[model samples]
Target: MRWPAKLPAGTLNRSIMSAMDVFPTLAEAAGVEIDSPFELNGRSLWKALRDGKREPRKDWLMFASETPIRGHFNVTAFNDEWKLVQEIDQGLLGADVRTHLFQIEPDPNEHNNVAAAHPDVVEEIGEAIHRWRMLYPVSGTRHELVPPPGWRAPKDWAGYPVAVGDLQDEPAPGMPPPFALPTLDWQHGEAGRLIYDCEPYAFLGGGLCK
Candidate 1:
């Protein structure tokens, strides 16, 4: 909500809105024209806000990592009732991939993995993700997923910190299995450079690297 003189002031609708909505929404509110051939992925919330409706403005919203195809692909789609998290190349290390489901209302903490109990819901949400990806495919990257040795977090929350000492081997909840550098079998060279063979059908640089 903005405090500007032109904007409305009220408790607006409860909705799962995407960050993508900001561009078009702000444009319309400011009486600016955005001429385009492509259909936008987001809708403006101005109508619901102007009418003072408390209903949801959108049915669902999507969240994903920028380089989903590059490495540790993480994508999530959620509605008012449920959420689905799909992880690929888990931990940005190797090929452990899977999906987990959660009931948003009851499991506020998102601790319990109800996927086993609610296969139908899992299938439904998974289809939604599939459709969305088909419409707007995930992007790619040239750099390797994991960084070289001696790489440290640039910011406070950057790199994943491994547990040490007594708790070193314990698995962190909701996180994929810890990455063992040895498991990757990366061939190390001078100046800390590392290399690995791409899979036979591995997709990279907008095509198969092999």
Candidate 2:
């Protein structure tokens, strides 16, 4: 909480919050107007911070990736009570996904596998995750942890790094342009491909090639 903003101190809020909430919360606190084409994923927590009490979680479903880094993803979906985790191996093909479920409110450490006991919950959450994932544009975000045969960081992070605005719009070294994409088989040839066999139906014919 910002000191000048007068947000309360020493507040224990049980509300489940995602990093995404920071944007909306801070923007509202700063009195910044937000204009978006669609509804935002997060909400302002300014009220809860002021009250310093257990805040009701407004967001019911949240998706996560980049646990510590990209390529290897420990994707999690959860609400206030139930938490679902998928250990994804972002290797070459990246098809396998191991799911783990826990009643987060009770077992925050996630010691037990309650998935078998709660088939309905698993199906419900899993289906929601699938639908949410389907919203991805399919133009990017390929999972690849195994470094290529020969590759090294171009520059050190503490040294030189390209900003998003300074980055080139051109595709990577061997990436094909959009016009030529429809004819190519993304599965075999493309360097940037999403997890194997996981692409949506539109991606089959390179219609949604990254």
Highest-scoring model, TM-score: 2
TM-score of model number 1: 0.56
Clashes of each: 0, 0
Off by over 4 Å in 2: 58-61, 64-73, 88-94, 137-139, 142-147, 151-210
Residues 113-210 of candidate 1 have per-residue lDDT tens digits of 89999999989888888788776655432333444432333223343342222222433333223363232223222222122333323223121213
Deviation in Å, model 2, residue 21 alpha carbon: 0.7
List clashing residue pairs in candidate 1. none
Positional deviation of residue 93's Cα in model 1 after best superposition, in angstroms: 15
lDDT of 2 at 210: 39
Tens digit of per-residue lDDT, candidate 2, span 115-171: 999989888888877776677522234464443211123333463344333434444
Q: Estimate each model's TM-score.
A: 0.56, 0.58
lDDT of 1 at 166: 21
Local accuracy by lDDT, each model: 0.59, 0.61
